[model samples]
Target: MPTSASVRPALNHLQQLDGIRFIAVGMVLFDHWMVGRIELPLGALGVTIFFVLSGFLITRILLSSKDKLSNQPNGGIGKYLKTFYIRRTLRIFPIYYLTLFILYLVNEPPVRRTIGWLALYATNLYMARHVSWMGTVDHLWSLAVEEQVYLFFPLLLFFVPRRWVPLTAGLMIIGSVALRYVLYQARMPWFIGYVTMPACLDSFGLGAIMAFWWLYERERFGNVFSRTRWLWISIALFIIVTTLTKVLPAIPDSRGWAGHHNIMSDVWERLAASFIGFFLIGRAVIGFKGPMKWILENPVSQYMGRISYGLYLFHNFVFNVFHTQPTHFTVRAWRRLSEMMPFLNSSYFFQFSFYLALTVALATISWFLIEKPVNNLKDRFSY
Candidate 1:
């Protein structure tokens, strides 16, 4: 009953995924800026969401373009690889490198020393060894993971036969689990396994598997997605897994990275979070109409999604400044205003508003002046 088209259809901007991006970045913001101030296992969940999204989106793109990779005129594989890398570089490098350069000038020598690792997309490795923040660039570890994924995953997708891709993803997931266990047994610092690709690649690999399945086998994918029960099942699993593994445990010792360092606990948490991310994201892509869809596909959520990359990048700096110097201009102004109107300053409201305002302004400016402009050039190298 399925059409025999070999090439998968190109997809439009996925509103649900955009909404998911907003949620992912929002979690990161809460984690970095408001965890102790509020209380949630948000940072890890946010990072996992981002990793899963990257894997899903990248695999989908590759599968859709398989025709070009196979049959493009003159050196198709090289051309495809070049185009992929160039497009990715253009999308990622300008803002990322600029952020690093700014930190090198503004921050201390520790940040300067880590520039090598950051530049080479090895920040995760650097942080694994250092086990602490490198000025405000500590979050670069997630970006580094993505960069490394972009580097190798394309090669795997391009060369590996399509039927075997799922199996490869499964192996990768197993390898990451094995790596985590081995490292934990060897008495390596938790940060090493936690931050490195070997421990986290399962999230990415699982996402890739989902993308491959969806693209290659639309009939089965559709049959499952059309049933609301599957979505309910995924949501149930996500809730149960997260509550048992993350939420309840986090309440007693809510120090996040400092409090929860057990290897087995982390392994389960990451795996569960990834599966949750995959299903949530998968439902959105499949056009499941529900309250979840409505929330995720709203214009506001999509806008938040649009500026998410910049939001994720710039928010930490905003948090760092606000946290360290509460007397800074925005903070001062807000505190003074709150003195005049007591309600404004209640319960971290002033602090949250200050960071949100600055981060949004910076992200908007970056999107208009930098990211959007460079992004326009992406089509030039398209396969």
Candidate 2:
């Protein structure tokens, strides 16, 4: 393994990481569009990838900020916190709140009933409490989890001693797994185990651990991640564990055992998926090669990754569920198109393509008109 310090530079933008983001959002879109048509947990896998990626990126940013401010005076810490919160707000809050506002204007019933929780970024908690999804806005649970994590994770990183950060993250990982097992044994709703902030900590913790290794243990990171075998091992572990959840007989009151209802699905499947995400992210950070590099770094993938947040935000709404009134114009238009051109309704692929195209279009529009312009404000709050 190369022990060169040059491998880890100041974290700037990585296009390959965006490609990974594209893959993550693609999984989510496909899973939601083809809900009962597929047996795999592509949505969970995608969300885990997102959580790990968020943890890695945010931890890197925090650590880098800590390093920069270490030499400064008393106000350095304040500046660090201010800059981080401001940038995060600029990136996350604008579109999110705007979406809520629009939904409120349209009198969307789910939003009307849960606006309080949604506004506070506690949609995950609301779902856990209610034990029911809030329709199309159900996907917002992961966003809520990420927002909640952002609220405190920076403080944890900032206050903890540098040497202990990795240890702290490891404890978080273990705690999350333990929490899920406890919840499963208690027979709490499956979404509680899946969506609650504490139960989802493992994915974030794994990402944080990888970030720390890359920053402080470069040679070790390279030694492990540079080899292709670890990646394959992670894939095998994910597949094996996920497959077991599918193939195993369900326990009584297991909610059919596929969607995080069983102990294996609730507890182990996510951890397995997190490992895959951890290796995938670590590998992306180091670099990719050959066909994999091309796949991840191409212009289309990069652009998709750049707009992935919008893609994820708008995709579920684009999918018209049977017997549900279509509120989104794209969904309504698609319904009209299906009726006018009956052939479009003949195959699942046609519907999938329509939804994908509309989602991409909406995401593209949001990227240019809303996200990009607001994101430019982040430059004013740079760390």
Model 2, CA-based lDDT:
0.85
Q: Per-residue lDDT tens digits of candidate 2, residues 40-159? A: 789899999999999999998888787777667962789888999999998888888998898899887788989999999999999888777788788999999999999899889988
Which candidate's lDDT is highest? Answer: 2
TM-scores, all candidates, are: 0.88, 0.94
Model 2, runs deviating above 4 Å: 1-8, 254-260, 320-323, 326-331
TM-score of 1: 0.88
**Colliding residue pairs in candidate 1:** none
Q: Spell out the clash pairs found in candidate 2.
A: none
lDDT of each: 0.76, 0.85
Off by over 4 Å in 1: 1-8, 72-75, 108-110, 231-235, 238-257, 321-343
